[model samples]
Every structure is written in C-alpha cells, then in structure tokens.
Target: MSKTKNSFNHFAWEYFEGLEKTQKGNTLIRKKGRLELICSYIGNEPISEIGSPRMLEVLLDIQANSLNKAGKPTDKAERCAGIASDVFIYAGARGFCSSNPAALIKSQLAKSSYGHRPAITHPKDFAKLLRAIETIVGDPNTINSLRLLALLFVRNGDLRRMRWADVELATGRWQLKPLKGQGKVNMVKDQVVPLPDQAVAILHKQQKINGHTEYVFFSQTAKKHQIISENTANKRLKDLGYQNIHCAHGFRATAKTLLQEQLKYPLVLVEMALGHTTKDPNGTAYGRFEYIDDRSDMMQKWADYLDALREGRDTTEFRADAQNKADSTAQLKALIDQLGEDKVLELLKNKD
Candidate 1:
C-alpha cells in the first residue's frame, strides 16, 4: 500500500511548515517535536482514517513511555493532542480532514498531578522575598531583571526580550507586542506596560550597561538571542533559597493575587495591567489602551505597595488606607456623640 498525499506524515508536515513560517525560537522547535512524535505513530496512515479512538490509543502509548519537561510521567501526550488538533483544524479548513480526532481526548489521558508554578502570595512573605532579591550579589543585569520582574510581572520571555525602542523611561511606558499574542487569537496585541518610578530607575541603571544593545537584558552567552538566558532570573531565585518557593514566572501570580486581594484594585484594571485578555459584558475584547489611565494608576500603586513591603513598612492595602482611617474616625465620633466625650475617653482609656 502506498501513502496518500494527505497521509498523516505529509499533511502534518505541511501544517507544521506553515507554522514554522509564523513561529520562531523554542516554540517552533517544541511544536515540531510534538508533531514528529505524533507522526512517528501513524506517519503513513491517512489522516482522515485516524478517528478519536485510534488517536487516543496512540497518545496513551506515548504517555506510558514518556516523561514531561518536569520529568513527570504524564509525558507530552496532552501537548501532542493539542498539536494534532491544530493540524486537523488546518486540514479541515482545506477539506483534507472532516473532524479533529485529537480533540476531546485530553480528559481521557492519564491522570497526573502537576504543581502550579510556585509563588509567594502573602504580602509579608513576598516582602521578605523582595528584600532577599535586593541583597542578591550577582550580575547587575540579572539582579535588575529580577527587580523588574517583581514590579512588571510580565512573562519571563517578554522581559528578556524587552527592547530599548519599546521602553519610554521619560513617559514610563513599555509598548510591545507580547509573544503570546502572536497567535491567531484576537487579544491585546500591543501591551502597554506602565512602569513605576522604581522600575524606571532600574531601567535607567540598565541603560548605562545595555543601551548599545538591542535587548534590555543583553547577554553575550545567550545562543538564541543576545538577551539574557531564560534561566538567569529563576537561577538567581534558586540561589536566594527560593528554589521551589518562588521562580521568575511566580511574580505574575503574586501580583495577580495581591493586586486584587491586598492592593484592592479592580479585577478588570488589574487584569488589563497584567496584559490578560478579558472580555467586557458585551463579550467584546478590550483593547490595550481601553483603560490606560486607570491601569497606570494601578501599576503605580502596586509599585508603591511593593516598595513598602520591601522596606518593612506599613503595607496598607492600596487606595483603601485613607478611606478606612476616615471610616474609623467617623465611627469614633458617632460613639462619642452617642455617649459623652468623657465616657468615650474613659472607654478608649480602658481599651488601651
């Protein structure tokens, strides 16, 4: 039997070749590897003949023998399924395949326990982590990268690929096309990062070092780009005794939690500042500049709160401390009016 033009191997390669045109760096490599894995199982089989059950069986066989990047036994089956689904979708659009067999099979894969990215969410604990970062004695590029990571909380790839042209220190804004936004999904493609005073100062210091380079965190040893190694920030965290306690990507979770829970920022504004794609009530996606002014204020407040936390100062919930203090005063005055001034003073004295 001869393989057809639309055989799994030929069509999947066609799909991936198209993907390679749009993707770069490790992303392209990883997707290609996953496609190869799937093709290894059914390379010569007609893609149209590979139903959901057959796909599931091949994935299960791969799962049984492979380990994930974290060395987990779950393997790359889930990711392979995703890649296969993409290929089938591509093929279906051109009338090569009728349906995606790789879809709806992820739930049937082996149940595996994977840990969430470790992060420090508690304010006090996170404060300690910040202080520890300040004391880290190493390459200034790595140190400043970590500092900016805490303040910016963007994906590590975004930070590493940060360019001088995108950063406006005078206006304290970073405008860039986020790597994740390069997909077919309609998201906030151009993310506007409002830099705080502290972050601006760090960038100023970095300017003297990397101003001549393309990337803000320039590195001579980086093979993929002149930017710093992806592990630079996390490796420093590990050296600071935060091996599993925290990592570079943890800052996003930490900021997301504290910005809503501790800093008292509105979820929509916080999500916007974090470059997350959130839909409005009408199901329309918000643009990057939708709430620019409000997000700017939130970013500043978040930076100020982090400063307070690092200095071991009173890290009151952002924008709520003053109102809360005023409320307390009004309650005290009402009590004093209900009782007598002398009685209220006596009660206060007793409480003290």
Candidate 2:
C-alpha cells in the first residue's frame, strides 16, 4: 500500500528515527518493536483518523493475544499503549495529530498481574540458595555470570552485556551507562560499580574464556561479540530448583535486604551500589563517584559476607568494615540501633 507521510506507519517511523538520535541498545530496540506492533494493526491509516476508540481496539487486540516475559497476558498491551502514546505526542508536536489517542485509552487496557521479581530475602534462606547455586553445572559463562551476579548485584541486562572496555581490573571498578537509565529522563546517565576482590577473581576466570572478545560474557552461537542470553542464568536457576523463589535479578533484592538487615551497611551506600538515583534535600542528584571509597569498602564487605553465608557460618555479626573492631564498636552499633544509621553518622560527624 502506498502510505502518505501522515500515515500512522510513516509518522511512527519518523518518531523512531528521532528516538534513534538519543536512544540505543535494548531500550531503542524495545521501543521499535512496540511501535511495529502498533503499525501491524493500523499502519496505513492516517494519523488523524486513528482516534481513541481505534487505538483502544488495537491495544485490546494486543492484550487479548500477547503475553509478557513472565507469560502473563495484558502487560505487553499496557506497554504498547504507553509507547503509542509517546508516538502520538511526537506527532502532535509536529502538527500531525491534534491529540494523543493512545494516552487516553491506556486506562481501558486489561490490568496486568505482574508483581515484584521474586527473591529469597531471608539471610539463612538466601545463604542456602547461594550454596545451591555453587553446585550448578553448565556453561562456564552462565556459571560465572551467576557467581558475579551474586557478588555485584547489577541489573541482569547490565551484567550480561558488560563490555571489556568498561571494566578496569587494575582499578577494581566497572563503569558504564546502565541500560535502564539510558535515553530516559530523570534517570542516572552513568553508573560506576566498585569490584570486590571476589568479583575480580571471577572476572579473571571469565577472562581466560572471553578476554580476547569484546564482551566479558561471550556467546559462540550469537552474533559477533554478543554476550550470553539474558535468560541463561535464570534458566539455570530454575533447573537448580529456584523457580519463582529467586532469579538472576533477584540478587539485587537479596543483597539490598541482607546488606542492611544482616550486615548493617547504610541504605544510601546500598542504593548507590545498586545504581539508583537519589536526590538530596536540595533536589540535587548524587554523582556516581560521590562515595567511591565507602562504596568500595561496602562491596568488599558484601563479598566477604556472601562467602561466609555460602560456608554456612554465623553472619549476624558480620561487618562491612575491614577492621575486626566489632567488640570495640558494640556501643556504636547500639547507638545506631537506638538512633538510626543516618542520625548516628550525623552525630559522629558533629563530634569530629
């Protein structure tokens, strides 16, 4: 069909080209895929002709047939509706459409049933899970990926797509623009992860297999320099009897919970290590390098804690500090427990 430039299909492609100027990686790919879905239904129609009713019909059709990664129905419909709304907004800005139909119809889509990514948060339960992960026999890349996921707890996509150039083994830091934050507003543009000794050791093991390749986790069957599959670790976890109980991404929650409740690291440090953007009272976002030394110390301590957990030892008294001054710091812990970590830190700074 000969479609006009004002056709929904043509305008969507134009908007995607604009997105390409800023978005990249999976973020761009996902947006394009969602737009393609919309085009599949009404590509040849003029933008002004596709109203809220028509957009709702297309989205409802998608909701009826599509399933999300979790095999749930309707989540993909909501996502497509959102992406379609973005396209309409782009067109409206350029005078192609008067209003955003997709935006108006989002509420009519079927409600999705997805919940938080399942994770084993209890320390003892998590430790048992970690020990079980140790016995998983499979591709070295998948195995090492699981190991490092536990150690670093970065997003599953960030870990899988890690590049050699972004890693500095000598400096013990892995720096990159996180996939989730890329091309999005109010999201951190850069993330810097301090590599613990255990993580470095695991990377050294991976280096033997993929050091020559561009990606740290290299895949033979994939396109050149592509990393392993995103589900590789999760599939192994399922086989190891952790289905629905924990997943590769769940390592973040596992670490976040245990680091605060078990190991007693401050929440700010944990959140920073997890690559989350937090604004202070002045609405200033903290930089990636704001607390590098403290984060480095926290990373090492977390690795040590995991080792202790894997070995099935008492981790209640674990500290993220290098010095074994637990006995001397008993009063400090009591103070923190009494006044909270933030208040305790402020008190110490004031005293100093």
Candidate 3:
C-alpha cells in the first residue's frame, strides 16, 4: 500500500485484478479506493491489522470527529460505526488480521445517537438520469445488459459479470455467485437474485449475442472470460450529460427512495432488494434469513415503479406500509419537537 492509500488498499490491487473475469472483483477494487479515502482521516494500515480494542476505539473517535470536521451537522455516528464493523468483519475473514475492531467499535456505536442521514437521489431527477442511461446503452449488445441493470437493481459490477447459464427464462431468476462471501462459500451461499419481467427482457436480448461465451454481458475489450469493466456503466452515464446526477451506485439509492417514498414498500423490503448485507444498529441484518418471497415481490414492484417512472406514467400507487413516509413523519416530529410544541402551536395559530 502506498503511504497514501489506507485500510483495505494494501491488497486491493491483488484482490481486484485476481478476479478480472468477474465483475464483483473489479468493484471491490473501486470500493477499496473509497475505503482508502475514508482511511485518510484514520490510518493507512490494512484494516485487519488494526483489530485491537485500543485501535478500534481510536477509529470510532476519528470517525465521529471526521463528520464534525466536515462542517456537516454531526450524523448519527452509529452508521459510521456499522460500516466500520462490517469492514473489520470482512477483513478478518480474509485472514488480513486476527481481530475485528469493527465489532468493538459497534459496541460503542450504541451509545452514540443515530445521526447518519441516508443519502438519496430524487425520483424525478433519477428518472431523467435513467432516460440518459437507456439512451447511452442503446446498442444492441449493451441494451439488454443495461435494461437488466435497473430491473435487478444490483450493483453495476455484479450485473456486468452475469453469465449465460445463470438465468432460467421460464422461472425468471438469475443465479449470482455471492460477491460478499468472506470465506469459501457453501453451495447454500451462492445467491440467486430473482428477476422481474423487466429483468427478463434483458435475458432475451443477451441470448442473441451470437458468441457461445460463458459470460452474459460480454464487452469487446473484456479479459479472458470477463465481461465489462468496473467503470463502464457509470462512464457511459457520464457521456450522456447526466454527469454527477447519477452513478451505477446511484441506482440502489434511487430504488431505496422510490420503494419507500413512491411505492411505499416496507423498509426491510427495500433494503433486502438492494442486497444489503449489514444490519441496522438495532440488529436488523438484511439477508441473514432468506428474503426470497419478500425480495421477489418487492423487486417486481420496484421494477414496475421504475417502469412507470421511465415511461412517465401517472397511475401507480404505493402500498400503504411504505417506510419512507414513516421516515418523513419521524423526521418532521424530530424537527418540530426540537422547535418545541409551544412553537408549533404558535405557528399553526398564525397560519390560520
């Protein structure tokens, strides 16, 4: 690792290039870069190396303080701690270190009030961005891959590594080798992400690629058996004037917002659809139990939601149990409570 790069960066290149043919490996490389930036405020050692309790505490302090330093209002430090916990657990499993500081860090996380805010892209703007993505990936070969992207709402890298034999068109499910596996995966851990009709359309397109290749989303410049580069989808989005408005990752964020805000699905369902591995501070791990039924239904609904948005339809109705609305109420309550009930009554009286 460069004195410059930190955390998971030490082995990121080896980690990334090793799986050149698989899209997930490529994304890990980019995510490592993000992790490296995050480490700039902490330290440069491999995360596995810093698993001692003392190191963990120091990391917690640094993370909490870094948010303050950024001049943004202090977020619930628990989320940052949660991210740290997942990182340590992941690093430790890889034999990078003996202990997990993130676990220790998580214990301390409970004491800090939830201050993190979920960053999301607005649905209307996201719709504009999707239009751009669809337009950019319109070539016969890339279009199926790109359309399937929004349908599954999986990470760009995972989508790129999709293989031909993985999909069962009649069943509408696409099998994916779990990207987040830390240890040698059991057959049980190999994932099969359910595909919606939107996702199915792409499968049909991919079938026409003409090459008897193993990969589903084959790019011309791909390495042996490899499909797309880690950055291709986002790079294409940039070309279409969308710029920073959307990214390959932004799709997940957009889905979260729309699922809860627009479609009114449960928070648990939204998180599951995104394949979130970490749990909330309240012990809500995303995929510990198979969410097959819940995720399948949610994904189909989500695909429909995106379809409506893309086509500019005005007739979709969200389920009544949506989490985004609940979140709004809670946020409003917080803001109003902070201002005091008396103030609210006064404002209400004035409005009349």
What lDDT does the true structure give each of the candidates? 0.86, 0.86, 0.61
TM-score winner between 1 and 3, please give it.
1
Q: Write the per-residue lDDT of candidate 3 for residues 1-352, one digit (tens) a residue.
A: 3533335554444443543545544345555554454455454665555655655565556545645543542433444454455565555677766665555555554343333332236777767766766665345656565566666767776787777777788987877755654343322235568788877776776777734787777766776545777767666766876555566666667777777777777776665556655456797544544678777777777777777777787625545454566788798798797998888778879999
The deviation in Å at residue 250 for candidate 2 is 1.1
TM-score of each: 0.85, 0.83, 0.56
Q: Which candidate is the best by TM-score?
A: 1
Superior by lDDT: candidate 2 or candidate 3 = 2
Off by over 4 Å in 3: 1-120, 183-189, 278-291, 318-352
Q: What is the lDDT of candidate 3?
A: 0.61
lDDT of 1 by residue, 101-136 (tens): 999799898766466889999988999999999898
- Pairs in steric clash, model 3: 75-115, 76-114, 76-115, 76-116, 264-322
Quick one: ranking by lDDT, best first?
1, 2, 3
State the lDDT of candidate 2 residue by residue for 1-352, as single tens digits. 4358889888888888888997777777888899888889989899888998898889888987886666677478988998888888888998888988888887787678667888999978888888888897768998899989999999899899899999999999999988877656555779999999999999999999999999999899877437798889899999989999999889999999988887778888888888888778798889999989999988988888889888987765466542557655887888899999999889889999
The worst-scoring run of ten residues by lDDT in candidate 2 lies at 315-324
